[model samples]
Target: MTAVQPKPTPVGETFDSLNPATDEVVGTYAVHTADEVRAAVERARGAALWWEGLGYAGRAERLQRWKGVLTRRLPQLCQAVRDETGKPLRDAQLESVLAIEHISWAAKHARKVLGRQRRSTGLLMANQAATVEYRPLGVVGVIGPWNYPVYTPLGSITYALAAGNAVVFKPSEYTPGVGKWLVDAFAEIVPEQPVLQLITGFGETGGALVGAGVDKIAFTGSTATGKKIMAAAANTLTPVVIEAGGKDPLLVDVDADLDAAADATVWGAFSNSGQTCIGVERAYVHERVYDDFVAKVVEKTKDVRAGSDAAAQYGPVTMPSQLGVIRRHIADAVERGGKALVGGVDSVDDRYAQPTVLVDVPEDAEAVREETFGPTVTIAKVRDMDEAIEKANATKYGLGSTVFSKTRGVELASRLRAGMTSINAPLSFAGIASLPFGGVGESGFGRIHGPEGLREFSRPKAVARQRFTAPITLTSFHRRASADPMVARLVTFLHGKR
Candidate 1:
């Protein structure tokens, strides 16, 4: 007997989106209800059939057109991102450009990576011709974060679209305007098909998207929220890719370039007001160059300012609630013997957190353990590279790490337990379209961007065809007693000794 599933709930009328920099009302978006989410998925499901029918060539053409629109409108989208998330205009532009790269890469590579290809038949199945192909999962739900709003969400949305799946994207509540801008651009290119749709609301809207039973869900947010997303996705047996929060570390060995290490640490930790998922929240320095690095870092950090002004080096905190969390973390770290060389507890304002660097901080402080998600970093002096590695790996979250050692950069990077390691650069892994972006442990699972990103949006379909019949028939109506001994001998000859 079939069990009855409840009808989806209806979405609300409208919701307000606030500008993180000014706390001003930026835009009003429809609060998508469960019914709207389900309808979007159903419409996407229908559109996906036509889309997938287009195959790789036809779809790539459409994707290229979409890319043209995004490329032309990059500045406008950057404006929207700046208004919504309070990131500097340059940062927003850079992230948007990176997203464009992903769109182009996904479109260009989808056919080759996902198209049906012949695979070798093993000895046991030598008589069969086998092939594998990736099929679109139809409807994909994406819940994005506010930080790097364009780059982060498009990482999922573009790949899904290229893989022949329609998307129902729920952008971060803080940056729904940027989300709408993207949807509007795509709409201009693919008007006939509602291939990409946008819905906006708070947690309820996101929950509705999850319960809508989309083929898969890709989420980027905090670790605690990621667990909830997983729990919600489980109810419908929907697979999910979670690129949650991180407390990424940057390590400097004794033989490292102190100036370059300082520059990378400052830029990596303080960029975007330090609201990065893979931001360098912690740094472990070899005691030999510890003082030199700190001096250079402090000197460079002094020149950077956080504000909504045009010349401000950094922007305001995108989420207001994060201010309190950032403050609490700084206070806890300071109380635990950490000394803030720059901004401290009072640095968290209504809209921005000044770039802060702390030293002598305990490894157990909230600033080190928890994700501050602000422009704050904790620098610890370690006895050796072993201690640096130990302290770096001590965190529960392992997303990204940066190592600064000319001689042993690759070797040390290989030892760090992270999804990506920038040997001499900070956050360079994200810009490279070929590398996979994700994390391990509590940082979350699954990946988006690169070859893995395309696979995440599609399911592998396998096919096997029999060219000729062999004497040893395993699945037959008639019994073959002698074939069993022959099969055993073959298995022994192939693998028993090995």
Candidate 2:
């Protein structure tokens, strides 16, 4: 199960994608260079014109057809996802379903969200007809992550396409097969042009994409890598929407259903081998029920295993190097006087990490302060919900969080310093199509998945048409001298009191 390093290939050559659970070559993809990336972007620029020409209705029709292709061939896509990322087939299916949901939502709502709409001229310009609309930004470059390869990247790609823009996607080097599947599916429906293209490689390929002059870059990965992407995009001042890493927390209240809270803690912390960016990495439980909650979470996690088998609850870590990080965090927690409630540092093997729950860990421990990105959770006792919220918000990453309380759910959720909080459920906001998804601080900015998401890949254009001559010619230099005083008097009468 150890990591398998690919043999060196010549420049501009191809590389092999390996299965994490078996170190077997799943697929071979090209290492696209800067020139090739630029060529893809250039071709996308032309495709964007035709995509925009389709209009909202026409584009929606084509998108619907593409959705059909994805739906019908979901099993194939799921297999590809599993082969490349080592996620269970069911997990891969879930990821594909969520991605399809986003595609459907974006296609259905793009027109209503971005179409032109009339606006009030206001008292100062009553003679002008004002309107505002969102316009496509031409071409978008998406650098996707390996974990949840299908669901996460589609969040940006689907919305960008629905907004009448062509896209050039660079999936993670580990999961290029899944990316190719998606691009090939889109091409099946819209073969007239390269409206959606695929480019595969490692960091250099993604860097090339950032410098390829695409209208905007949408990236999802580690915060460190996100910073590099932002810095690179700064040179050309290209706008980017980054959905980065997170050390998300889950809080348990004194009044919460201990069983449900424990279930959420186990699932939120360990699901997908805890490779999820928004997965729960820490938990804060009220002291009143801390022992009982921890007991239940331990009981639940005992049966959760990670492997490549269908019966396994989760799969191996998609990226093998992450195993060392997981080991270090667990070891650090244990060394800092934390007690392993379930599994310990030994839980992290060469490929998969068993569910490890640690308690009594100091607040400053690496397990509590950093992103483990593994199937691990650090539970701490908090005196009250206030303390829980404070400890949860202590981290620099403000991504996703969960609050398990019946009566105080919304109130406590509102106080948590995260982008999105689930009152009684784990990661519920992500399933809702209308809610905007993105984080503040290091988790990255610029939303995807709602009306804001539709607007993210487009730019606003305002229009003002003169309906008739105004009674006061203040805008013209030939206006009468008395117009200045008249305008002053009108402004004072309209807004002076306010």
Candidate 3:
């Protein structure tokens, strides 16, 4: 008998997550296969029934317990986030704190936002009683982004759970450890079943989850990947909420406080290594104060550094592949007559990218037009706020924006073509629990926060019942010849003046 060789292990059956700052292996995770993903969806389907059966109060009670667990073990969760994404411990803590707040908001307000409410029956159906309630969709697959892993994913996960739906989360391959930690923490509170389950792997695993017969898919990642996710979800006609890429901008008016605007610009552009989807990637300043604002920004960024130390302002780029894109954008800007007032292309290395401020760059430059997703910003001088608004709204991506103006703050903010705008502040919309967070254009559609977020993971269920016999029965075939003329007259009388 000939000896048979054992079958070779699949290429991506297992993988290790590495810390971007040190390249140290944080943990090893199994690369869940398509079959495994389908199995998870199946389990979630059953869990959804049980989870939904709990109703709003029961679900809120369990979610509150999970919130307590997250609050108590926040430090541990933040450490796990730091290890996987190379963010500072403080940044990790901030992300977790925001996520916990979202949980509390979703739990406390779910019943109010999604519970059944009486609806006014129209004149034609005055004798009927109508009610509407938001019902949870079963088995939501959340494909999360690595940047701000805890805050971003939980923005969808917490709200979905609060709305009484089971979730199957597939975090980025680089941040699987963080995903596992969150799932494990939730399991501690709701041990009866896997209400929130984690599946680890690369793009293939995420693709599998998209096609795993999920009722809905909430994806956060690049615009390119979001398109692919939509294509896959279309196979099953599953609805999706996509929080994709963004090329957000910050505007500085002449009447703005130069010092405060500069500080906001620096923090908005460099914090979290500028991996934020809503990070200020472009700055359009009024010509009257453009030079002064640029100088302030340059000076502010001088002390900022990226490293794996307590004193460093930020950490390394979470994904090594993004370094090349950062380099290309910087180099392209410089070659096209853009001046690097602070760091340049040379500041980017294999791991970390220092803060880079580019000025005199044309509107057509890659740094200005594309989503660089780096610690870099292009400062452009515009004649007025009109020009600034025009330039800020020029991009195909409009996720978030910032406006700094003493007098025209609200006016300018309302004119910007984006989903969320911060007035005299940086990223204020994201922290507010009641405001919806998403974007228009290439930033993708749908929301993940506030009352809209709770509704996004659910479907509207309308109930109509006959309270009494109507004088004219229009819905039925019986005795409807004269009812039609009466209904038309009623509608014309009620709406003709408008």
Pick by TM-score: 2 or 3, better one: 2
What C-alpha lDDT values do all the predictions have?
A: 0.88, 0.91, 0.91
Q: Give stretches of model 3 more than 4 Å off.
A: 1-12
Candidate 1 lDDT at 304 equals 87
| TM-scores of the candidates in the order shown | 0.96, 0.98, 0.97
* Residues forming the 10-long window of minimal summed lDDT in candidate 1: 1-10
lDDT of 1 by residue, 362-433 (tens): 888899999999999999999999999998999889898999999999999999999989988788999988
> What is candidate 2's lDDT per residue for 44-110, written digit by digit as tens?
9899999999999989999889889989988899899999888889989988888888888999999
Q: Ten-residue segment with the worst summed lDDT in candidate 3?
A: 1-10
Ranking by lDDT: 3, 2, 1
| TM-score of model number 1 | 0.96
